[model samples]
Target chain A: MKRFRVLDIVLGILGLLTLLWIWHLVTMLELIPRVFLPSPAATIAALEWGLVNGDLLPQTLATINRMIQGWLLASLVAIAVGSLIGVSAIARAYIQPTLEFLRPLPASAIIPVAISIFGLNSSMVLGVVVFGAVWPTLLGTIHGFAHVEPRLVEVSRLLQMSRWEFIYKIGLPNAVPDILAGMRLSLTVALILAVVGELLTAQEGLGTAVLHAARSYRAADLYAGILLLGLIGLVSNYGLAIADKRILAWKN
Target chain B: MAQNAAIELKDVSLSFGSNEILTGIDMSVEPGEFVCVIGASGSGKTTLLRMIAGLLPPTTGAVLLHGKAVRSPTRRVAVVFQDYGRALLPWRRAYANVSLPLEASGMPANQRPARIRQLLAKVGLANHEDKFPGQLSGGMQQRLQIARSLAQEPDTLLMDEPFGALDAMTRQTLQDEVLRLVAERKTTVFFVTHDIEEALYLGDRVVALDSNPGRVAYDIKVPLPRPRDQLTTREHPEFLRLRREMFEIMNKIHA
Candidate 1:
């Protein structure tokens, strides 16, 4: 197993090297303008410079804070509402058509409406982020709660378990795997909305920093900000994956 | 003077709209009695068990527990269903699954550990307390289900084809285990199964039902001695005679 892990690391480094080599080749050949895409060294230098001088860290932190706030809000509401609809047939029938209609509407499309109401502030950005981030979690949670095995329901009944006890012990645990999967999707949505919200709202976030760099033709800074965003995405995705593994250790 | 029978079905009849499932399933189980209901696939034996467990109400007549009509599942009763895969919570460890009923009873947190361990050990799963139900084998999962049910310490257990899905060897082992446990606790059991031999071996009395509007066709006592061995019990004259009689009745129903 240790050897296999070592092999995997080796292969991962090799894959990175291959991608970097491709980028180097593309720059050397001038297939794309240097103004449009900076070289790897130039991008790294700009990243170092920004860390040393600019508000790179602050902007990144701001974006992340907004993401956490919005993501948490979405998760709490979606889980609450999803479980409600999942358990009650009457609620599902009444609310399903509206959810179906709204789920398909692009989350980004609501930014203008949010901006008009909340007007270029954290609340507006948060509203957009929450709007975009909620669908995956809501849909996944509803599916999870609806599909708890019938026999388990019978077992709960046989135990003469109270409604609260049944939901807490059985319903919630059963929905967890699906709920986690939904959160994973919601994380991606949160990141996208965070960046989009910043760009639209003219907020002081990594997305705004990238927009600023690009507007001024600072290709290296633009690439550096974009790279940092990508890295954040990677780190968060892996973090959630590790958390999922730990939480669902009982599962095969 | 009270009847004190653990369960009584008073001419219980069930129908889904016009589709009659069971008709006149009249029976009474003495306290601590082991009664097995056996029949073919469409015999509604499971439906009868469900009625006694109060999962389904009889369309006519009533299912009573200790002379009181059963409206819903009560704390005094527990059910061990056939689908152990679905019955045991996939997210829970073996010990936690056994602790579920204890927790529901609002037992003190400090006292749960020993009780959970005791029940797990009773079902032969003491060493596997931390393993999840998905990791356990089919037989082991069934054992976990039994352990969970036993934790309730219910006066009556309603088993719906609890051993039907198991392989032959596992089925026999579980049958013996269930008998030993129930005997020790003096828990009244209403075991439903399609296997005639299983019914005879495990039951004090076998109530055989016929299909197509299911109703009791044969009610016979198993006079075979307790502490029955798989080999010697099968070899016993009474066991074979009862088996032959049940076989003929089942055959006639099929015909």
Candidate 2:
């Protein structure tokens, strides 16, 4: 395990170096116009300017906060409703069709509706992020809870566990791996929707900052914004991966 | 008579829709007696055990326990399932699996540790307490399942082919452990298995069921003496005689 962690860091550095090398090559060769594609040096300077002089820190934090808030809300609600539908036949029958219908519609398609309701605000961005993020977590949870073995169910019954005890002890724990998997997917969706919401709704966030950079033809700022977004995604994913390992240590 | 009976199936019949699984399964188990039911795959042995455990309802007649009709599973009854892999909570360590019933019974937190430890140690799983069910071998997992059931402290133990999946050596070992445990605790056991020899070995009486509208076909008292050894018991004249008779009957039924 220690060897693998070191190997992972080495591989990560190698990947970053390779990406930077490619950016340098593209600019050095003048393969694209300077205005359209920024030099690696220009992008770094833009990153410094954004962090030191611009609102990059606040904008990045704002985008991440919205993502976390929406993702957490979706997780809590989905875990409850998904588990309910997973275990209860009546609930599955009643709620499944609507969920299935709504799940397939793209999260981006709801942007217009959200804008009309909440109107160019943080709430509108949140609504969009939550709507987009809930499906993966909900569906994953249902799948997890539904597939719990019949034998375990019988054991629970034989043990004379109360309704709540059975659900908490057996149902929830059995669904953990799936729930965490869903949460990870939802987190990804949350980030995407957060950006999409800001871009479309003209809200103040990293997404809006990126959109502003692109409109003004500030290619260096655009590259820096995109770089920051990628780093945020990588960090959050790493955090979740660590958590998944710790929580489900018994699995493997 | 009914009050003294640990379990009684009075003309109990069960059907899934129009298809009958068990019919006229009339049997009685006295308190502390071990009864084994043997049959082929579709012979309703498991169905009978389920009825006794109150997990399933009979289409006709009644399943009674301690003079009361068995309607649903109670704390007084516990079951050890055949597929231990599925029966055990993979997320929980062996100790917590045993602690499940104790916790459910609303036993105090402080009281649970001793009981859980005792149950795990009873099943010879003391060293494997921290291991998850997935980490254990099939035999060890089955022992964990047994430990969990024992923690229930049930008056009646219903086992459905609990050792069917284990190898010959593990099967023999578990069989002895079960016999010893049940004998010590004076717990009433209703064991269902496909193996006729196992039925004869562990049971005070062996009940064989016929398939195709499954019903009791034979009921034989195992007059073999107690504290049966793995080798001597198998070699006993009475054991050989009963084995022959049961093998012939089972063959004829399959034919």
Best by lDDT: 2
Give the proportion of true interface contacts each model preserves, from 0 to 1: 0.93, 0.91
DockQ of 1: 0.84
The true-versus-predicted C-alpha distance at residue A24 of model 2, in Å, is: 1.4
- Backbone clash pairs for candidate 1 read none
Write one digit per residue (lDDT tens) for candidate 1, span A216-252: 9999999999999988888899899989999999886
lDDT of 1 at A39: 91
Scored by Cα lDDT, where does model 2 land?
0.90
Error of 2 at A112 (Å): 2.9
Instruction: Give each prediction's DockQ, rounded to 2 decimals.
Output: 0.84, 0.81
Clashing pairs in 2: none
TM-score of the B chain in each candidate versus the native B chain = 0.98, 0.98
Per-residue CA lDDT of candidate 2, range B1-255, in tens? 325589988998999999999998889999999999999999989888888888899999999998899889998998988989988898999999898988988999999998898888888999999999999999999999888888888899999999999999999999999999999889999999999889988999999899999999899999999998899999999999999999998898889
